[model samples]
Target: MTFLSGWGRTAPTPATLVAPRTAPELSALIAGASSRGLIARGLGRAYGDAAQNAGGVVVDVAGMEARWSLDPDTGVVTATAGMSLHDLMLALVPRGWFVPVTPGTRHVTLGGAVAADVHGKNHHVDSSFGAHLRSLTLVTADGTSRVLGPGDELFWATVGGMGLTGLITEVSFACVPVETSRVRVDVERTRDLDHTLEVMTATDDRYRYTVAWIDLLARGSRMGRSVLTRGDHARRDELPAGADPLAFAPSSRLPAPPWAPNGLLNGLTVRAFNEAWYAKSRERRVIQDLAPFFHPLDFVDGWNRVYGSRGFVQYQFVVPFGEEGTLRRVVSRLSAEGVVSFLTVLKRFGPGTPGMLSFPMPGWTLALDIPAGQTGLAGLLREFDEWVAGAGGRLYLAKDARMRAELLPVMYPRLAEWRKIRESVDPGEVFRSDLARRLSL
Candidate 1:
């Protein structure tokens, strides 16, 4: 038996692991799954239990053969499910094309990205990954492979369905045309929460991508001080003369230590780091590589290990527009309590896909990483969940670990619809995961 957990490295459980090279092999494996059920896993970047099946079957598809072809005319690419966004970018970027929407990391697989319906800084302009998907192939519980598109109900169900409906085998999506792999960024250091929100709300429309890094530890008048970075793909004219406009090589990663102490990232250290970061950042406009602009954390291998052996919980919740009060309240409480969040980010969301369970909507999203072993953490987060739900906000399932089952329905009003579609395709519940069983999805 192999023990597995999500990227957070928390609550690992033993399960039988299998790697299938082709759709036929995968279908056969699923058709014969035991009562314990089965779940698909990719690069395991889910941060939570969405990819884990305790005492059941966990299909590792990252090693599957990747077959991809790009249509240079339409800027569309069709590829197998196992292909990672990293490889996809390496291929597409050289040809002056980029993925329409990318989350914080490129290590995620195409199947996982589709399943999660990930959004990035560009969410305000491009929406989530599902919005760009043209079609996908899914292997159902009955071992039948079906191609689904935007017009199909099952397609929306599987889009952000957390892989409950079926196993995704392949995907096709349109890519964004880019004149250069470089980005022109405008940075602003805000005094406080209100100022930050005002600046972002006023100027975000001018850029294709925008994100704010919040100093959650700051209190009093300085609470919610943030650094907003907004950028777009640089045009050919914006680049320096003779520079490679389409150069696509990302920097090498610096691996974190194999292990860290439980208190490695405590309040003191995090506060110091936050202070230094906030002090050093000044308002400016500059040109940067796409990698640093999009996936700065990706340059640090095993970065989560810095949170210590006890692991950490990534809390990400989004409140609809006009609920800035809820966002402020959550930020104030976290700051007042002095909870140490190693990383805190805020982004603006735009329109959402038809995927019933997709996490994005027209709203403001805040994501942070807090040590799992912190005192009163569970109760504190539970309180935040209530506040978020009351404001009609929902947590991101892809980053969720310990959210209560009751709030799932309240937060996701379309839960019943999604569940019905899930049942129609997986009646026997052949597809399951720790998350599915945990929240009764």
Candidate 2:
């Protein structure tokens, strides 16, 4: 038996972990473990119990690494489920190609990304990860492999299904073209909630990627103040003369000290940091390397340790279109309550994919990273869930750790349809995670 946990390191559990090097091995393992529960695990980047199963078999898909061919003419690349976006970008970016969608971190595996149906800063212009998936090769519970495409209901079910339907063995998707691995950015600082919304509404469409970092500790006149960062893929001409187009120098990484006090990130410290951060950023345009622009936090390895041993919880929720008021109200409540959130992000999403349980919608979405030990944190989030559901919004299952089961249906209205499809493919629920049990998925 092997012990495993998620990035949050909150609930460590032991399970019989099997690393199947091939698709056939994966199928046999699933078929053999029909009575006992089983779940597929990728890079274990999910922040909660989504990847952990207690007293069950855990299949580590990271070992099934077999890179397939890429059709240059069609701009489609087929690869095994184990591949990470970081590796894929390294292979494709030099050829003037980029991923269609990428989350904030590149450490996530292809299978995990598809199962989570991740979204990025460009969700307003593009969509979730499921939108770019042309097809997938799934290993069903009965030890059979099948190909599923856009029109197939099983494909949509597996997308954002939390790996409950089946094990994804292979994935095929289209890639976007890029001139260089850099971004041409336009950044601005907003005075308050109204100003932030006004600026985003006025100019978000001009850039391919857009996101805002809000100061959650601010209040009164300064409530909801943020720094808006907008950018497009940098063209070759946008770089300085003689810059190497294909060269990507690895950025220096700073490690967080092993032992940081729990009280290090209190409200006073966070408020002061927010003030200095806001003051430092006025409106300006700059060209930055892709690493810093997309994955700034990545420059600090193991930075999650900054929160200490208890870890943190990331609350990401999307409110429906024309419900910006709901977003404003939630931010205001958090600010008034003095919740210390280090990073609060705001983005606008376009239409979602066909995945019944997918997270994105045509609306405004906000995500915050909050320490877990804060008083009444769980109760406060539960109360916010009601507001989110009332506004026809839903929480991102990939980032969720403590949402209640009763709220699942309210958050995902199409859960019934998704359940039907999942049962059709995996009637006995052979694929199960702690998250599925927690939410009764």
Candidate 3:
């Protein structure tokens, strides 16, 4: 059996990995695998076990390199699931078109993005990835390929369903138009908790994309202070006089050292880094490229290696709109307790798609990347789950690694409906993943 793991490189497990270069080959493999279950894997960017299925057959769809075609009149693009957002951007950006929604990283495949129903800095304005999807081609356990759309229950289940429903073969969606690949940004530094909340509430809608970088190491009166950045796609006139109109070059990236020590990111080091980051962001109204603005971490190739071999876990939760107080309480608790998360982001979401397990809602969402080796990290996240459920919030399954199965139903009120659809399509549970088993999905 071949061994494969997700992007996090944790919980490595053995499986029979098959790379079928075409849709027909993928279908034939699934049709032949009646005894062993199958899970579809894309660029393997899921930060957890969502893409890993132990002792089963894993299908890697990344090798299916099919190009995309656009419907000029409607701005709709149909592409194979194996296409990466990075590739899509390069093809569409020059034509005054952009993806409807993009997650923090552009390395994600189209199928992975849809399976995870990824959301981005603009989630508050444009919901999750599912919200923009027009239709999809799903290859079910029985080896039949079916077209699913907004009106179909199976469509909703597959979105944010973690690939349990079926293997997505193709995706069709409408793209947003943009004048240029540059971003006209406005940056603001907040002093404390109250100031952070106040600034976000006051001016978030003025920009198309918004996010806050919290100083998690701060304590006492300065706890929860953050640097907020907001921006909209730049117009051609916003560019400098000598800037190239057609070519937008992204900044170069430095790769992380493969042999970096495990203790390189301890409290003292993170605190110092946080201080320097906060001190340097005092400037406002910065002009930046779309790559750096939307995917700063992607600039550093293999940056996830910074967390060492233990990998890391991203804890993301959203509390309802009226429950901002509960959100603040949790942030305050994390601050007072000194949890030592190197990256903390806060955003507001609008509504969500009908995907039974979709992770967005009308609320405030916060995501923090914590090294898995941190003491009591698992237990602490479990505790946070309780607070999130109490406030009618849920964790993002794409980023989840250690959530309780019992709590999943509480977080996602539509779990039962999703399960019904899943069971109908895959009655024998032939399509499964480590995440589906862990969360009882």
**Model number with the top lDDT:** 1
lDDT of 2 by residue, 1-441 (tens): 787877766677888888988766776788778455899898888988888888899988887865866888888989998898888888888888888898888878899999999999998888988999999988887877899999999999989988888889889999888899888999899989989989898898998999999999988998998999999999999889999876665577888788877768789888899999999988899998888888888788777878877888889999987888999889989998999998899998988999988999898999999987999888999999999999989999998888999999998999999988888878888998889999999
Question: What is the Cα-based lDDT of residue 76 in candidate 2?
Answer: 94
lDDT (Cα, 0-100) at 211 in candidate 2: 96
Q: How do the residues 1-441 of candidate 1 rate in per-residue lDDT, one tens digit apiece? A: 999988888788999999999777998898799999999999999999999999999999999999999999999999999999999999999899999999999999999999999999999999999999999999999999999999999999998999899999999999999999999999889999999999999999999999999999999999999999999999999999999889999999999999899988999999999999998889899999999999999999999888887888999999999999999999999999999999999999999999999999999999999987989989999999999999999999999989999999999999999999888988999999999999999
| Alpha-carbon TM-score of each model against the true structure | 0.99, 0.97, 0.97
Residue 360 displacement in candidate 2 (angstroms): 0.1
Local accuracy of candidate 3 as per-residue lDDT tens digits, 41-159: 88778888888888898888888867799987788999999999988888888887889999999989999989999999898888889998999999998889999999999999999
By lDDT, the better pick of 2 and 3 is: 2
Q: Rate the local accuracy (lDDT) of all candidates.
A: 0.94, 0.88, 0.87
TM-score winner: 1
Evaluate residue 353 in candidate 1 and report its C-alpha lDDT on the 0 to 100 scale: 93
Q: In model 3, which runs have C-alpha deviations exceeding 4 angstroms?
A: none
In model 2, the worst 10-residue window by lDDT is 244-253
Looking at model 1, which ten-residue stretch has the lowest summed lDDT? 22-31
Lowest-sum lDDT 10-residue window in model 3: 244-253
| CA displacement after TM-score superposition, residue 205 of candidate 2 (Å) | 0.9
